[model samples]
Target chain A: MLFDFAKSPIVSERQYDVCILGAGAAGIALALRLGRAGKRVALCEGGGLDYEDESQEIYAGHTFGDPYFDLDIARLRYFGGSTNHWGGYCRSFEPVDFNRGYLGDDFRWPITHDDILPYLPEACDIVEISSDYQDRLVDEELGLRQVDFKYSPPVRFGEKFQDEIERSKNIELFLNCNFTDLIGADRRVRSVKFRNYADQELELRASAVVFAMGGIDNSRQLLWMERRHGARFFDRDLPIGRYWMEHPHFTIGEALIKSWDQANLYFALTEKMQKSLGILGCGVVVEEQGDSTTKRLIKDLLCVAPGIGAWAADLAGKKLICSYRFHAAWEQAPNRENRVALSDRAVDRFGVPQSELHWRKARIDRETMLASTQQFNAFMLRENLGRLQLRDWVYQGDEYPDDDVLAGYHHMGGTRMSSTPRYGVVDGNCKVFGAENLYVAGSSLYTTAGYNNPTLAIVQFALRLADHLGKVV
Target chain B: MNRRFFSIAGFLALSLGHVPLFRRYFPQRIKNGWLLKDEDV
Candidate 1:
């Protein structure tokens, strides 16, 4: 069975068992998983691969989280979604993280950490990281002694899995298509509308629709369509585009650790610690920030050894951009106020309502910064090998409601999954709370920022959703 | 002159030591830097 989806928009009356939207990490990951299970799938994505689109801009948009920090955040109008630009940070979300115990909100996730834990290997495949990083926190609920770190040969999935996706008989990847809105009957979402960039093709429909657009676009698209199309259709009874969260992380400090032979910060780890921490995939450095959480670069500390930097300098600016951004992928906590909602939105070139993110910090968010500073200091004290220094003019925040420069790469929790439709948009299994055959695939479903990053968790959840949907949807 | 004053003070202290003279006070906040405000959740 050959599936031919070229530049032509797939808006015909064909019935696919699964219609996945936004071919970024979440969308492509789920599509791949479902296709592997012999399920017929149609995947749609906005934007094109890499930074190829002439219009793609990182710093032009409003700051929901600092857009500048996420240099690789690109939406492919093509296949294999944003993984084309994503850094391969393959760390798992811990168990207690699933609960809303810390947030004090009525929200609780429908799924547990254990439910999606088994899909780590598949998640590794989706991220194109090593399968054997022992210390990379495998099923931490089962007794997390230390993290297992590994490095991806660091290839993005768009290039890595392009052949496989194209070759997959069960998967039909529809590129250059945008998910306009959803079409549902009764209480179930039956299909979603896909329009072409040139408007050559009309609205295409499928049986099941998944909004796999990245966090910002997903929130904007859902809320935009909801406002224009009416509230009764797309899970509108709940906070449709409210209570958004992003991990407010900053580059508080950097250090040169002499523990490894390379004696640099970012990527020189001995085979022993990598082995001790379960080496082979994710990169980790537990260093101190003294008393600041400035920019969101994974876990207060990261490293890029001298040799790699030397090789990178020769690659020139644009040539080595993807690799350089891939090196710097890391984040910390998700503060609720550091989110996006409807503002004085101006429509983008696509005529879709783009958000003016009121990405401000409240007094409560300051506690995390203070805590980050404290924690960094403690970690530096404990791990005595590295000498920590401020990146200079790095500690941006003064206090709570203090205007601190912060941003989050992991656009988490807008159409969050919960047991209750009132508190969330989807169920634990990634299903729309009230509607059948409607789903979401992105970091937006995360109830909290578990500090370990969302790609791993999103992939795991996507795989689980496929399994669950296979049985029921 | 300082010795004479010390001697007098020592005598006064000796006299005062026999009698209930002073009490102590404690500061708010604990040693670990945690402060307690209201008890309500």
Candidate 2:
């Protein structure tokens, strides 16, 4: 049952087995799982089925430390969440990503890849992605192996799952509802207060609650709650709204291949080589070189691969003039300082404190880019597969380029998961450490971001959380 | 013996043809200073 809280009469005090906040991929995925499991679910969405400028304004906030997209436009505020504009590139985290020692400094997950691997098949189905992530594709002509990604139809949760949710007997979707405050008593969330766009206030109780409000909102809402309701509201000491990370997408280099056959090698790398090189996966898209760009590529290539450079220069009208862009969505080193905090001065239309993000790339981020670029260079040189004219900033000092580039809009890691309370906000089970029935879903629980996009892994982790909650709740 | 010698010769010829020898000596240098344009070179 869908209720437009603005027009619908407020149900003063409702109770359910599970109450989910935020109707994004994580929230909707959990609703489907819990509903199918025959548990009554009250799924709350802050906005209606469509985008609204007034509602979207709630996301407007200030950025403090690093340059970033305006918080207002970075994430869509309506139903389906950011998936409304998702590009749907899907791949799983590397097995190495789960190993604590790989990243060090307790920047590791209490859970392993095996924990989430079981739910991937169902997750893939939900996101409309077919075929497994191909980690290795051989380009024998260039003697290189590359990783491949599968594209989703890019499922908008609102359109794709709305009808099913409306039809579900056990799931009640409350739209146009704003989660105003969480009322907790003695470590358990007693009830949550909410409002409609019409200024109608309501409250609900649940056996268990999950905050699936994305990286930004999950942390922002919790940060506000902790301040008003006391630090014990979420975690007493452990950080919240901190360690916010994004995949910094920037052009690392431009390359030119000898022919179309040689061009494919630059597109992806083999899983074997990636592991051996200790680098994250990335893709290279070949763009046709313009007249001036072609001249530049030739001159650049001549210094590296003189034979191929000469071939490209002399080649007839076969359109061999090409330059490639290395699109790397590498992981950001999870630093405590790259965070989001409640803005002291500003409040949204709902009169709630707005968020301010303090995000900056660290030394590890710079090293990863430099090392990964060098690894690709080595492979190209070893394989005799064309050459790359490195990006100016890559060779320049350690400072990263923040002017022309933008963050991946993949907000991750604020309420991170760990085994204990000292390091993380949520437990291995994605439950808030201090609160018994409170849990967090979505990329917010990601201990570290992988080069792969978050939508697939977001669904995978949500399903895993649902499976865990379904047993006890 | 003739077949073995011919196979080795073919391998060498292919390697020399596809993978140029000069690349080892004067591989594209990612220069430290500003990027060199065609006119600059």
Highest lDDT: give the candidate number.
2
**What TM-score does model 1 score on chain A?**
0.73
**Candidate 2: misplaced stretches above 4 Å?**
A137-145, A231-233, A262-292, A299-308, A315-321, B1-28, B32-41
Q: Give the Cα error of residue A97 in candidate 2, in Å.
A: 0.8
User: lDDT per residue, candidate 1, A337-389, as tens digits?
Assistant: 44455546456655665665645544434343333333333343344333244
fnat, candidate 2?
Answer: 0.00
Q: Candidate 1: fnat, from 0 to 1?
A: 0.00
Residue-pair clashes per prediction, in order, are 39, 8
In candidate 2, the residue pairs with backbone N, CA or C atoms under 3 Å apart (3 or more residues apart, or in different chains) clash, namely A145-A269, A145-A270, A146-A268, A146-A269, A146-A270, A147-A269, A303-B28, A304-B28
> Best-fitting candidate, measured by TM-score?
2
